[model samples]
Target: MLKNDQKVFVLLENNNPQVESLSKQLEIPLITQKQIDSHRDGFFLAWRDNKLALFDIKSPKKGMSVEFDARSMEQPSWPAPKTGTLAQAIGKKTKTVVDATAGWGQDSFHVFRMGYQIVSIERSKIMAALLGDGFERLGNQSWIQQLNLKSPKLIVGNAIEILQNLEYIPDCIYLDPMFPAKRKKSALAKKPLVVLKGIVGEDEDKKDLFACALQVAGKRVVVKSPNYAEPLGGKPDLSFAGKLVRYDVYFKT
Candidate 1:
């Protein structure tokens, strides 16, 4: 069994005084580690916040793998269409998407499965490492070989810079950033997410992300928000409903 004592130095978001103050005021833990390495292959960073147990690898870009349950990769089955997913929203108008905040690549995978080509970006090296590993595993899956599932093309670096330089503008740019959890009582209980949150920190630059997404998207930008949080970048011209939240859409001219 892999020991839990593994530790690596990662820049803590709370290392900044202002960040630390906010973490204390908001009561959010900061991120601080990179995880498991393989001698033959590259290392992976664990997304502690994700319940899905996703791990992205450290190197080898493009056709990156995403590992969900080991069982799911080996077995051929489509992930249930998350009915109210952002994929469904943008899929209606665009055949391609850029997940500007790819994170653990959950939403990016969903977008790809919905038949849209995806360009995903992540800034955190640890998160990118985890994502890279996950994509490598995803690429090697027997089912993926048999069925030819669409795999994400991941780029490690700031989306704000990468998106601006992309040759083609995608139909949609999706953002599912880290927002303050709804309630403090509800926060402490999300164990899987807590770990990830500790490592990635909150999406401190969500505002810039939204602006950049708006500029780069061909048709529109969809921002996923908790039901209780205010719409990002003000009210959306249109919105699609989900049980617990809404997809706020900002159409581009």
Candidate 2:
């Protein structure tokens, strides 16, 4: 259930059956863009520029959408070469990964582009819908079609429960739970993360989720956390530090 302050509605400009169906399925109101004024402080879901996007009422002009393409402006190439901190954390030998906390799906998509089999799990209905739409778009990309590439499989449910019931054991279980900012700073947080926090709240049970991942992961469990925050599952077997985040890996003996 959504928080009182995080009310979300679906915006339909015309007789869009697909949007209408999505609104019904999500149990959110379907309204026109004009109607958005009434819910001036709420967030909205709409199709903008041929992609499903989430718009905050405060900044409707700057909506957030999932994109599988390379994020760096300098690197316009698709399927960026996987030789970074994330790849190091996931390990060179890891073939299958289960992203147990796939918020926004940026990490999962990155790993997928690296040719690793990925399964993404998202609990929020809104995030799941956005991810589903993004994956569908990824599947239709010319490069993806020509190479017969498949997008990461998405599973919508509580990760604590889903991790235990996975049909196949994955080589690595990755967790990137939301952690509170270390200190209040002058710079505003990223729009996508701010909007996501408002909608999904924080992951208070991340430790429990980490514990569960340890039990189910075939080889190792990787927990991504703010560099300043304490590790979720005690001391890690190895830790890889990035610019603002760290990946703590716990190997299964």
Candidate 3:
């Protein structure tokens, strides 16, 4: 559910019934293409090639929509999961994980694909809606059906509050709190990252989030941060490195 002040609405090319149905499901206004032209300012959820997506009309170019794809599952061979990346970070020891900051859910998706019972939490209503759509798309894939894969349960709220009230603790708590951009030229140009930054803003309470995650996790809390940002909750018990990101693992004493 979105805040009353949220300007998001459903953009339709015509009086399409599917769009109307989806609008009701999303609980937003249904507007025509002409309405979109007039209100080309805020964000809107629309159908692009029969797939639901969230797009910002403020972007520089057109046809820019934020949708999710499990790249690791789709193309397993090339750019495969690295040795010390997400898979290995929560591999043998971590049975269940709670991803506290599930942005686009790509990391959460890959973590789930690696066979961890995972749950995700996102505070932004817009991001949560997009993530819901993404998970739905992933569940509908033929391979997912053959393998009988289900989407990770999503909890839409401030994770700092939700993590504190969990019924049962998980083996690991994963945090990928958003920080100000520090990447190179190419990484900054990526669509989802660019769009997410524009929409979600920075995680001001990330340290508190790490502290709360530390309280409920059974085994450890894994904080994903750029190598330069320092550890989220001071020094980590162990650390694993990726191309640009690193997982700072804090084991429960």
| Model 3 weakest 10-residue run by lDDT | 75-84
TM-score of 2: 0.92
Best by lDDT: 2
Models sorted by lDDT, best on top: 2, 3, 1
Candidate 2 local distance difference test against the native: 0.85
Q: What number of backbone clashes does candidate 1 have, counting pairs of residues 3 or more apart or in separate chains?
A: 21
lDDT per residue for candidate 2 within 46-163, as digits (tens), equals 8877888999887788778887654432343545667988888899899999999998999998888787899999988899999998899888776777777787899998999998
List candidate 2 stretches off by more than 4 Å: 1-6, 70-81, 185-188
For each candidate, give its TM-score against the true structure: 0.69, 0.92, 0.83
Model 1 C-alpha lDDT per residue in residues 1-253, reported as the tens digit of each score: 0111132222243334443443343233434433223323322222232311233234313222344655555557664454555755675658778888887777777676556778889876556666766777677767777777646888988888998999997888888887888787574434435445655668778899899889888899999878888999898878887777688888887
lDDT of each: 0.65, 0.85, 0.75
Q: Kindly give the stretch of ten consecutive residues in candidate 1 with the minimal lDDT sum.
A: 1-10
